[model samples]
Target: MLDANIKQQLKTYLQMLRHPIELVASLDNSAKGRDMEALVLEIAECSDKVTVKLDGDHAVRPSFAVAKAGEAGRVRFAGLPMGHEFTSLLLALLHVGGHPPKVAPEVIEQIKGLKAPAQGGHFETVISLSCHNCPDVVQAFNTIAALNPAFSHVMIDGGMFQSLVEERKVMAVPAVFDQAGELFGSGRMLLEEIVARLDTNAAEKDAEKLNAKGEFDVLIVGGGPAGAAAAVYAARKGVKTGVLTERFGGQVLDTLSIENFISVKETEGPKLVAHLEEHVKTYDVDIMNLQKANALARTDDGKLAVTLENGAKLTSKTVILSTGARWREMNVPGEAEYRNKGVAYCPHCDGPLYKGKRVAVIGGGNSGVEAAIDLAGIVSHVTLFEFDSKLRADAVLQNKLNSLPNVKVILNALTTEVTGDGTKVNGLVYRDRTTDETHTVELEGIFVQIGLLPNTDWLKGTVALSPRGEVEVDAHGKTSLDGVFAAGDCTTAPYKQIIIAMGEGSKAALAAFDHLIRH
Candidate 1:
């Protein structure tokens, strides 16, 4: 993008110096000295100048790839271009920018024909939209588009443009088409393969409009434990898999600490998310990040069309719903403000990070008791606050609580305010419920073991849901929808344990496999 203000001002200045046709004609890849563009490029780069460093053999090396006019021109990266990196897109942008990204001469010729260069340029979706649980495809498009102004990059929402999508006959939402409306690629397309198409001129814009079918061996939704497990299984089984999640990590990302995930021993949520991301990257799974399924429909052919937020459609033979739940909040003041900073819901995820620290555990249920007991082992002190006169946990847990020296159980207590040092957790103000007495409890982190809400609003119309809105699935994790399957805490499973979620995820994957194979 040109400097917004400067871009506007320069657009005016350029308009004064050159007309639209002159500017349009000057856009050829053969230019070395377009005075107006050169001036604009220098200005854009100077103002939006970002430093890019890529990991090298031993140390980080600097690369100035994108012209100041573009982002990560050839230098700065969108993020770490590791596994599922957008390296090709970066190269594409360079090709389109004056340098004209080099495709085989044939591919270049084909691409030139994909769009009438006169209609101006091509449209691209760069940078995978990381909306929520996801497959990050846009990243590749963005990296290339940012560096080359010839391509207009957009973050996709599968539910927004039904007309453009239908005109292109888009079967799977992420399908990239050229200006001529020809399908370029779907799923994880290799840079070379796509580049090859640039010159093929052979593939028509409406090629997809003619294809009769679209299917997936397994389609796992949600990117939490269950969805991740399902993806790894389906991929290893040689099943053509497509994993879609609005975000890569579900509520799990907000988890601060996790004490039990099997081999993990103890870890933070982000690290756990990173590990899962690494695990899934090993196979041929299409992970869509930030792409939400707006409506799930049964196509005439019986496949599923996962309509995304941007009006794109993705089809699959079997679908896995792993969208998980979120922690229930008290909705108290300061609670929302210090969410990740201090206020937390899972003690297992963030416990150790606050070692030798003071934390308050709310509620007197099994989770609250468990959190207090767990925190007692790592933090300096554990303050367990209960609104009732006594702990409502299991007798055994209550008995164990009495034996803990670092745990403090406060009866009929309610949190009034959270006092923090802006950057981190500092202290809190609490009140005695029975006597209506207010007292200040100096604390650092507050673990609220209240409740949780499942992320399944979009599934309600398609699948049967429990009173709480969780998708109702059978023992094998099969939903009421024929080809639709679900897993993890999002199901009606009673215990929200990590191992159980993984087990259910595997079950859903296997069940989806069976369904896909049988069909």
Candidate 2:
């Protein structure tokens, strides 16, 4: 059922359709199958060039192929497409209908040059329709398939495919898997990173080639706001600067809304991430995306030798660890089992998908309280649970939470289990420590807003670490190591805000540049 406004928009968007696009739906007589057929037919009715063909012989009840008329489908989407994925579906239609690829030229060339395995590779991108970052990952893989015929890509809705999500242990969205390995971590990643992930041999070779250029003047080890800021600053100095990151944007991509980023009144995590990447790309910094620093050591020549997970090594004169933090999990039963199914971490990323639904926010801290207030505006009702006797959030945040009519707060409640029907989350079970009474709250989703753990586990023993495992750094973002620096949430920075991280990253870059000048 397409709304009038949306149908009109689609009709306008499809007005310039150069060629016919086909939706080859593989469906049986099941409910999901019938729904899939209806969805495909609805999409086709929007444009004269679009058509739907039903194939009932497939083993899978609800799978589909999207391609041009009389052409074999190169892209397939399994499971229902809704929420954020609806945007992905519309974009896919535009692409397959003869629109040009929006990817960079070098990226297109690299993807085109990718050679599939002898038997061909079947790439699967596990995504939650609600994830803001998931669409880009899907678009990148689909574009790659469009550019190169050697490979094909399928997009699976993580929420609908609960068994597959569990089997993959998908804690986050955009979890890609292929014969090669997990391309990047479970989050938003640069498109080049996705391409590099699918072809590690080529990536390793690229890393080797880059390293052969001798030591860099400054090497930033993370791709968050701070690392990106540092990269921009250092590269502007006309020095050989390189940045190594598992993925760009770091925790920023996990965030949903930003009202205090300075200057901007409001923005989303992914938009800011795009700005960060765009700003970094304006410089000549050698960005090694999808690369993690496995180990760090000082070379005999007074340079830093950074080993990657793929066994590649890069040498730099100065290094900055801006590795960010990840959301803390509850570790309760069914929490991990029903991650995307009903248990979510980033309220900003997944909140819209649960609009008008009952949800719970775990934790009484500022993050949890803030999430409750935020979700109250989108969802029908929000239940806030805190293990402490009272809320630990700032008085202002507590006041905001108290003012929300759709939110209910529970103190001294210990979450025991995330109740689900082996498919999606349905309710949450907890116990009141004060009365020793158990309570089960019926809700479709639960948002865990505990705290964040620093991403410095890989740097253990190499750099000075605090008692809490955060990287110990000086005021100038300098680590105990003479030529190394650290910043952002991974460091000893008192604040973990986006603006603070950007400032810290800039400081770290300047410190590294100063060290280079001194030596």
Candidate 3:
């Protein structure tokens, strides 16, 4: 049943509905099947422009297709659309009704380039109905399919296809696979990643021509908040600025909520990223999304040269490093396989997706405790597992976690494996130290918040790195290298907050601008 508030919202959003649309529900006539039909009918009642039709197709049971009247829809949801996926359903309806896409121009171009005389490929994204991150990945793939007829896609609900989940060893949501049955990736993937997966050679060839010989006054490596900020500042100074990022938003996109951004009372990671991307677009910064900096070197002319993974070389007078940090995995069995499906590192990104589902937090430190506290409000229950005998979090954080009625803390419990059904997380196995007994807890998700790992593997011998691998920088964001600066979580900044990263990025840009003027 639809909530009163949500019903009103849908009415307002669907007022622009053009051309009658049909929601074809394929059912098995089971209890769940009847409920699915009712849900579709309820949605149809929201507006006269939409209608529900039933088909007793057991193969596509619990699935629904949204298409214009008298047409077979290309967009199909092979499972229930609930939780965060509800918004995705709403957005799809809007898109089908002449609402223009919000995909980046470069991404659209890539999709167009993939077009061929014959069908090129197919991408299937496996998702859970509650997964908030699943919608973005689904929408991204849908956008590609809509743009180019050469490709096609379907959003498969992991819960509905248990056999396929088991075959793929799916442990997370938003897992993408190709027509060849090869797993492309899991988690919240960028559009560029999908494009690259579609045509690796073409992606490389395209990167080769992306200003391989052009010189810039300032080139920022990494696409997090810091790098984005630095690029904006340098570009505003009228310098030839460029940004190389594997993905824009960095770890910030993994973050779920933000209340400490200073001026703003509250915001989410994706919203902040949208603002950041919009801000970056306001400038002439040459943003090379999905580009990775492979190696760094000094040219004969005393300029900095950054070699990309695609073999393209970008030479610049100054370079700013804003490569951010990543989550440290538990490295246990099923951890990697289940990533994003049921095992998540970013609680903020995936927590709400697990609403009313039991989840486990591996670790009893500050991050683990904080995650447990956050999940308590959104999930049915939270279980904290610590390898050590006692929690390492501060007294205040521990007190806060203790206040949560649905949270359980298990100390000296070593996680042995992340066990799950073929489709989603179902339980966790751990070993109790004192009793030497193994225990299994039934849960739907696991959030690993043990530690943060800096993205500086490529900079091993190129720069002065701290023992922890963070780039060492000074007050002015200067590194050991004369013409190189670093900022954000990748640098040895005292803090790793978004606002701190942005400030450091501004400092690095100002320093780079100063170097150009004084040199």
Candidate 4:
């Protein structure tokens, strides 16, 4: 055995090596024992704030692949931090010692100049990209990992870690695991809360555990137009409502504008959603934003169990689904580049903005032909391109489109390229299948009138789905499952109109009320 004096010296040296004041080249396992010992002893003799740099003699790249807790000195018995992720390794060393990484000046300023040491606690950040829509949220967690090593962070990419995601009941991105091991915060978290959770100990854990127990009368699982309407309706009825949403505005936020709703002639989609939010908030509903619904299980007691992104759960007497649909996009070259710039999907939304402009319509179906004829009256010209040999629209609409003098019907043509001048669209390139020729149509906008597909894949087995994948519901918005009902674009409704979704939401709420009273 080594002398007691030698062991003390070695331990002190290891502590110094891990200090925030020092920068290490590499704490490689390949280093000779004697060489390490000598380095340690030499550093012990130095001043209180000794800076012992690692000897650059080992591979640092493939060493710190993943970071974890170190028992006394070594972590995971592997300690091979890999990649230029070596940067993460450095931050890990800093965590067991120095303060959390400093936030940017702007972020620091935004937090009201609040810079307190993180509470002495633990947080497990869980993320699952089942829909692959929340990458920004995952980046937020990675930034948290970059902050302090004392914070144990693991990314559960559901695509890669399906079983773990199922076991944890994670259905969305950015689920926060609290110190109590009970899931706490779900979805994107404010950085201040993250800082507060760091280094927080057991006493606080007990309190948080007690604070998370409560149930709602009605739980709304979406924050779109229909969902928002339902929330307002339920809360006003004094049913004690709760709203869980992946995004606060749901699919309505993606809309550019809305002219159909019974509003002030025209309104932007986001503005309309914001107004709806105000109405919903006027009631007493519990609002949980940026949260994705994870699971729906019926408790043995017959209460509806709602699992969320972070594994936290709630009990509800009735559940309403208002998560809406996304507009279909033609992901062709330049199409995405000019979307919202020159490529618009909803004619009723961005039509007036393009008055007297030349526009190209890409589908030959009913919606496409109608949009083309509509634009021909407003825009300088309209070019309708269809992949089929003939238009699939109704006879009346087809005759109307053909009768429009300014509308040019390009039969058997497919979009190849959307050439643009960065800010706006210049022209479109088309390929004719019959002639085996390609040409470009110089225009200001390309309106995508392709049919829309509802975003109901997440509900495939959660609730009943139609053959086309939309949620199946009755006129009263009752679903196949008890205590569960659906509305809006995600359901198998005939017409996908704003008024229709709102009307359905009202019906769903009444159904929920009746179900709750009966039970």
Candidate 5:
């Protein structure tokens, strides 16, 4: 089952294993079981420290577990771990075989110190192979399971087990569940976030530590492309640079594919974000991830102070606001109530859940039209609603959308309400702009692709903002506040693209440096 190139790579990675490991397969007479057996056997051939066992008794059929030799496995895969999960499988193998993980030493120690609840903790994550956000969640749980025996995790492929997915009513990828109930809904999450959720005193401890941090010369408020670029530029100037963000990568982490990133021919969002974080790490920038900024103000000393949600304050001589935008939501009733139930923002991640079911794509821009075209293959039918008189998508995309038999585009249609059964979406309500008539379409899912809204709500009274809530910045990326700057989608930039954001971030960094020197 393993290709020659993959086998060679596996051999090289396996050389790092310090202890023997076993690939225990739970198989049946099905083709998938045979494939699993073959994969395990081929994996065993790659290294002397690896072995395979076929007499596994896992509950999930055609499943496998990667365990240290002679020990019970805590991490299991219920389906073939390919696509984005291929790396997850490799990491599980290496980590289980005594190869140290790349996580911080403190985090590793924290994981080891964690104690499960009285009922015990067993996390089960439902994921799709095409999902870009699932790998991090899977690897996180696996890492915890490897470090602490009190916790165990299983990665269930939703595509492979449709019945289980329907039973759980999971409409999105990376849905995590514990024994009590849903641990985390669909989204990208980090190990730190997971640990904080379980460890009750973690937030207070983290806040105390953050409050003790020294002042920075240049502090960035986000960790997207803009924040990352600003960090690199500021750190190169030999100043104390720090990046404070709720999570690195921001909205870009939800993005699927990028073909217009300048020199790079093609790449995935997570892959690019990984490279961005790695590049930033090569500098002297201090990265503080998984921390949200709640407010901004000027200190008595004239330095800028950014407050965190946990009541911790960080002071900096110069600040750059790169808090990027997020998907614009339709404030209609039932939309927020049924967010992950049937309403989704990312088509690439949640489209598979609505396979063979009817759905609606709201908006007429490139994102909406592209979603319709992509969903045509998986969904039974796609009804696209555009409020404008005509589609705003590119001509090429419009033409392609028109060719799909499963997709139907309606112009001059305004979405007024989202109708659901209190649990999941069942229909949609819209109005005809020309006829003044209302219509409802019964569907199982709704994909919102209208546009992005700036994440500058926290800076409303602190900075001069445009009507659209974007930070009003000059050509030099300088905001109205002295020693303060803004960039990327959160600012009044003309275009909202990755390349543009990076350039703006660099410009803002230089402007901040010049201001520092002048002061």
Candidate 6:
């Protein structure tokens, strides 16, 4: 199953194992089962410390567990951990084999201190191999299960386990579940976010710690490309800098392919985010993740005060707002109710879930057309709807979209309401703007790729905003407030691109520093 180069890489990684490990597989007589068995055996051949056993009687067929020798397994995979999940598999092997994970010391301690519920903590995450977000969540749970035996986790490939996906009504990637019901909400989540959800006192403790921190000379209020660049520039200027964000990588984490990042010919979102984080870490910037800014204001003492959702208040001499934007949602009735059930935003992440199924793509812009084209390959058919009289996508994309045999496009069509059975999507309602007529199309999924909205709702009254709710900034990235600046998609920047965001962030940082010295 693994190529020669991959085998060599796996052997190198296996050399880091401090103790012996075993791959215990439960397989049937099917072809997939045979493939799984061969994969385990191949992995065993790479390291003497690794052993394979095909005597596992797991309830899920074609499944396997990576366990320390002579110990019960806590991390299991119900499907082949390939594609984006390959890293997760390697990390599980190394971690279960007594190799230390690259997690924070406090987080490791937190995992070790978790108290399992009376029913025991068993997590099952439904994921698609194509999803870029699934690996982080899988690795997070795997790390927890490996660190503390009290918790166990299983990674289930939704594409392979169609019955399980239907039973759980999961239509999105990385859908997590526990004994009771849904554990945490779907989408990308970090280990800290998962722990905070499990530990009731975690948020309070974090808030207290944040409140005790000293004021920063250049405090950034986001951790996307813009925020990272701002932090780097500010720290390089010999100023105390801090970055507070809900997550280190903003909407960029959900992005799949990024080919227009200037010098970099092509790259993936998570990979770029990792490099950005590593570069930021080389500076003296204080990086704080999983913290949401609830409010922003200027204190009476001439300092900017940013309050977090956890009730922690931080003061800074100057602040840069780069909270970024999120995918705009369809405001129809059933859209919100069936968000992850049938209504998804990222086509690249969730396209695999609807294989051989009919789905609809809303919007006729570049993102929407691209989504329809991408879905046409994985899904049985795609119906694209546009409210405008003509498509807004580029000529090249429009031509390509029109050439897809499995894709259909409709102009002057407005999405009215998403139709679904109480559990999952069944159909959709739309209106023909040209004829004032309504129509419904039966489908299993819906992909919305309209646009993005700025993450500046919390700064409504504190700063000046455009009619579209974007932060109004000057040419130099200066906001309405003297000491406050804005950049990235959250600001009134002409274009929302990674390189543009970084440049604006650097400019905002320099502007803030200049203000500091003049005062």
Each candidate's number of clashing pairs is 63, 0, 8, 14, 0, 0
All candidates' lDDT scores? Answer: 0.61, 0.83, 0.83, 0.63, 0.92, 0.93
RMSD of 4: 17.9
Model 5 agreement with the true structure over 1-519: per-residue lDDT tens digits: 889999999999999999999998999898888888888899999999999999998878889999999999989999899889999999999999999899999999988999886657788899988888899999999999999999988999998889989888888888998867655546778888898877878889889998999999999999999999999999999999999999999888888899999999999888899999999999998898889999999999899999999889999999999999999999998898889889998888888888899999999999999999988999999999999999999999999998988899888998889888877999999999999999999999999999999999899899999999999999999999999999999999998999999999999999999999999
TM-scores of all candidate predictions against the true structure: 0.50, 0.77, 0.84, 0.50, 0.98, 0.99
Across residues 150-214, which tens digit of lDDT does each residue of candidate 3 receive? 66667888766777776786656678887778777778887677777676476667666775548
- What ranges in model 2 sit over 4 Å off? 1-65, 76-83, 97-100, 104-110, 113-129, 150-197, 200-203, 331-343, 348-360, 373-383, 394-400, 403-408, 413-446
- What residue runs in model 6 are displaced by over 4 Å at the alpha carbon? 181-183
Best by TM-score: 6
lDDT of 2 by residue, 8-125 (tens): 8888888767799999988766777778888888888889999989973444457888887887887888877777777777777887788767777877888889888654666788
Q: Rank the candidates by lDDT, best first.
A: 6, 5, 3, 2, 4, 1
* Weakest 10 consecutive residues of candidate 1 by summed lDDT: 17-26
Tens-place lDDT digits, model 1, residues 1-519: 234664455333332211111001112122322332343344334322222222222111111133333232322222222222333323323333344443346434543444324443454332222222112334444434443345544333332333444344332334555556555455333333343344343323223321333567787778888989999988988988887776676766655568877787888665687888889989988776555676888999777877765455778888888888877777767887776566766565445445677889988988789888878997899889887898889999999888999999999887888877765567777788878879988887888897678888887678899998989988888889998888888889888876788899998888888887787
Q: Over the stretch 83-110, how does candidate 4's per-residue lDDT look in tens digits?
A: 2122333343444343344555543333
Q: Which TM-score value belongs to model 3?
A: 0.84
Candidate 2 all-Cα RMSD:
5.2
Query: How far does residue 500 in candidate 4 sit from its true spot (Å)?
Result: 1.2
Model 2 lDDT, residue 268, Cα: 88
> How far does residue 37 in candidate 4 sit from its true spot (Å)?
70
Model 5 segments beyond 4 Å from truth? none
Residue 455 accuracy (lDDT) in model 5: 96
Native-referenced Cα lDDT, model 1: 0.61
